[model samples]
Target: MNHLEYVTCGTCSRLITIDVDAAGIIRNLSFLGGCSGNLKGICALAIGKPATEIKNTLKGITCGSKDTSCPDQLATALEQMGY
Candidate 1:
């Protein structure tokens, strides 16, 4: 299994740590240094979900009114995996 470490930025409400495996799949996720509810939401969404699926859901998502953010970057990273 491969692992990709990422940090979520912008109006993310909190910082997120994402771990993706070799098959472009999410192996585990942890929301660090952030709100409990928000982190729980993210963690719940990410766990057991495919990397591609997660990327697709978060792709092009802007933080607050911003056009780009770390979540978008995370999507890009997943896309780069070619899954």
Candidate 2:
């Protein structure tokens, strides 16, 4: 299975690291330097989840009504893998 690591920008959530298996499924996820609630929710939502589902679910999620968000960063990471 493949692995990946990434960080999210904007909002109060500063960073996140996630490891996804070759099938684009999340095996693990961790949040660092971010707002507790948002980060916690992200981690929970990611674990054992497919990247495509996550990407679709989080698409266009604006952080506090802003332009970017942690979920978007996760989507970018998966898309970079050619999802």
Candidate 3:
């Protein structure tokens, strides 16, 4: 297992930290400086799911006027980890 810390751009969140197991399944997830309730919900749904799934589900998402959202940044983090 390895823990990854990804600095985000263009979102309210400043950082995202993730953990994935050998099978590429998400073991833990957290976001810093974003929507509290929404990030909590994301963490709840993401834990134990395949990283690939989450990456695909969130990759292209955009937030209102910005080019990327918290979810999209999470996807970027997963991709950087080679999901």
Candidate 4:
């Protein structure tokens, strides 16, 4: 299992913390300083899912005119954590 914290860039969320199991499954996920409901939805969708799957699904997503969204940053975090 692995526990990692990532500071976000180009998103409303300031930070993201994730827990991954030995099998590369996301056991828990949380974000700080982002959209409450949206991040909650992201958490619900991410828990118990494969980190690679989530990373693939969320990568390159953008918000408004920004180049990166919270989801995109989360994907970056997952990748940095060796998902």
Candidate 5:
């Protein structure tokens, strides 16, 4: 598995750490310093999903007019991982 930890930029969350396989399927995911329930839900949705799929689904999401959100930051992090 490939592992990466990312510090989110311009989002509510401060950090995201993840593990994925060669196929880009998520093995684990976690967030720090965000809306607890929502972040947990995001983690649930993300685990076992392809990083590319998650990135595509979440890349443009925004929070309350902010240009980026936790989800969007995840997408960016996935991209940084070369998804």
Candidate 6:
């Protein structure tokens, strides 16, 4: 397993951390300084899912009129990490 942590930009959240296996399946996930309940739910749903799948599912999400969202940031982060 490998651990990845990312500092988000242009969003209410400050951080996103995840644990992924060799095949890019998420083992764990966490976020700091965001909508608490929603983030926790995102983390829970993301666990054990493939990073690529998550990224594709979340990549274009927007928070109101903002160009990006917490979920979008996660996708960007995972892409940067080569997931």
- Look at candidate 4 and give me any clashing residue pairs: none
lDDT of 3 by residue, 7-33 (tens): 999999999999999999999999999
What is each predicted model's overall lDDT from 0 to 1? 0.66, 0.73, 0.96, 0.95, 0.94, 0.90
Query: Alpha carbon lDDT of residue 17, candidate 3?
Result: 94
Off by over 4 Å in 6: none
Better of 2 and 4 by lDDT: 4
Choose 1 or 4, whichever is better by lDDT.
4
Tens-digit per-residue lDDT, 1-83, candidate 2: 66666656675655566677877788887766767786788878788889888888887777777897777777776776566
Give lDDT tens digits, candidate 6, residues 3-44: 878999999999999888899998888999989998999988
The residue-by-residue lDDT of candidate 4 on 1-83, one tens digit each, is 79998999988899999999999999989999999999999999999999999999999999999999999999999999987
Measured against the true structure, the TM-scores of the candidates, in listed sequence, are 0.65, 0.79, 0.97, 0.97, 0.96, 0.94
Error of 1 at 21 (Å): 3.0
Predicted candidate 1 versus true structure: per-residue lDDT over 1-83, tens digit per residue: 65555555564544445667766668777655645675577668777888878888889976667886555656765666564
Better of 3 and 5 by lDDT: 3
Deviation from native of the Cα of residue 17 in model 3, angstroms = 0.6
Q: Where is model 1 poorest over a 10-residue stretch in terms of lDDT?
A: 7-16
Q: Stretches of candidate 5 above 4 Å error?
A: none
lDDT of model 6 at residue 46? Answer: 89
Candidate order by decreasing lDDT: 3, 4, 5, 6, 2, 1
Candidate 6 global lDDT? 0.90
Count clashing residue pairs in model 5.
0
